[model samples]
Target: MSSLSKLAYYLLHNHSRIAANLVEQGIKEMNIKIPDEEKDHAVCVYETFFQFMGDSLEQETNEIPSKLIEWSKKNAEGQIFSGGKISEIIIRYPVTRKIFADLSTQWAEEFSLTNKESIKILQKMNAMLDVSEVETVFAFEKLTKQMKKDYQKELDTLSNPIVPLKEGIAVLPLVGTIDSYRVNHLMEKVIPEIAHLNLNYVIVDFSGVQTFDETTASYLQQIGSVLRLLGIRTILTGISPQLAQIAVAIGAEFHDVTSYTNVKQALENI
Candidate 1:
């Protein structure tokens, strides 16, 4: 089918649902609407918006452009509620499209990047497309940033050696989410830091960490074991009840891992 014909078919079948969902989301985010006179512009934008989302279903999860997020935020802040219905239609279509694209990419690759997994992820994305755009965007932004930070941290850990420290101690302050990628990064950094500083203790502070899953907790458990092998002590700090639950769920036992409630507390114990 021709692109235009396919788009028209989609709109004919899905416009009401799309428009109502997007408008409601925009209202919650910034209190906006589409004016009756500007409905044509809104429809045009929505059509373009759907095309973008459809295309994104096939892309990699970590490839969202930051420009889209900035532009959507700008549109919402400037015209969510005040530009009448014209603003509603004009702004929401693009904003919703970006959100759809972000969620589509995230869900599509949360497990694997194969075709089968991608299709399942797409279904989940469609379900969430009706949620608030503002909240969705917020989560997308936060998650993407954490992913990027984890990536950069890995690169840094691999390329650089730890600086020497006195008192045979080194501290690595961890903020945000922790995943397998981050666990590998920490492992790289810790070994080199231990060798370079000749340190017997390495403290990892989870004070700013928002979430920790099984992979991360298991990584922590392994780190403690590895450090003991090297005759170094691993100190874990900032263990929240939620993280504790995750640790248990993952069968990650910290019984052998030296842990504390916070960095300060860990230091005192050290």
Candidate 2:
């Protein structure tokens, strides 16, 4: 066999040991701890990576293996699900790269491979690792964004809950600072929930609201109009003077809506 083929054969045969050593050296150098259960999985992933590297060296191509790309994505997802940061996963790459470089040099000397052949192995290893890093980061970012969107959807559901007070009465409490997103959530989600409840009165209490602006006034007016259209009497409570001023400034009329000092007053009168 050619020197390059022999070196590739050696690497392929000893990948498991090389992977274990890489992980051990990485953990020691980086001062990071991996759980016992995860350690085996980590070693397996690295072993596959080394095997792919060996394959690349034999093929004399810099193209990353599709299996390695898939594995990198899975690793990124695992990190997110395990409550670990992407940075934690990425931080070990440098240590791993150094270990691979050292191993490549040592293996070249043992196999009596020429300098060009050794450099070719190093080049393939670098290319595979670079692509793996990119894939991992991209997957991590995409998952994180999706997670934030889901969390916001859950928060919106909680913030605009329609709590039933009696058979035909419910309270729609608006909590936290009002934003365009929350306003849209109210129109899209809360309105449908209110309609399904078959309620006669909906007291949109703003006692917990921390923001009063022209846009907020407009959204509040729109909600009141929608409830009126559904034949539900809308009661406005906890409208501070600042809120009242903004409502007037924005020309948002609540003439048809009843006003109350608080939920207790609205509940008692309704």
- The lDDT of each candidate is 0.58, 0.85
Best by TM-score: 2
- What are the clash counts of all predictions, listed in order? 5, 0
Which portions of model 2 miss their true places by more than 4 Å? 241-256
Clashing pairs in 2: none
Q: What is the Cα-based lDDT of residue 256 in candidate 1?
A: 65
The lowest-lDDT stretch of 10 consecutive residues in candidate 2 is 56-65
lDDT of 2 by residue, 111-131 (tens): 887898788777778778899
Scanning candidate 1 in windows of ten residues, the lowest lDDT window is: 58-67
Instruction: Tell me model 2's lDDT, rounded to 2 decimals.
Output: 0.85
Error of 2 at 17 (Å): 1.6
RMSD of each: 15.8, 2.5
lDDT of 1 by residue, 157-249 (tens): 654344334488777777677778767876876565566667888786776678877667777778778778888887778877887777778
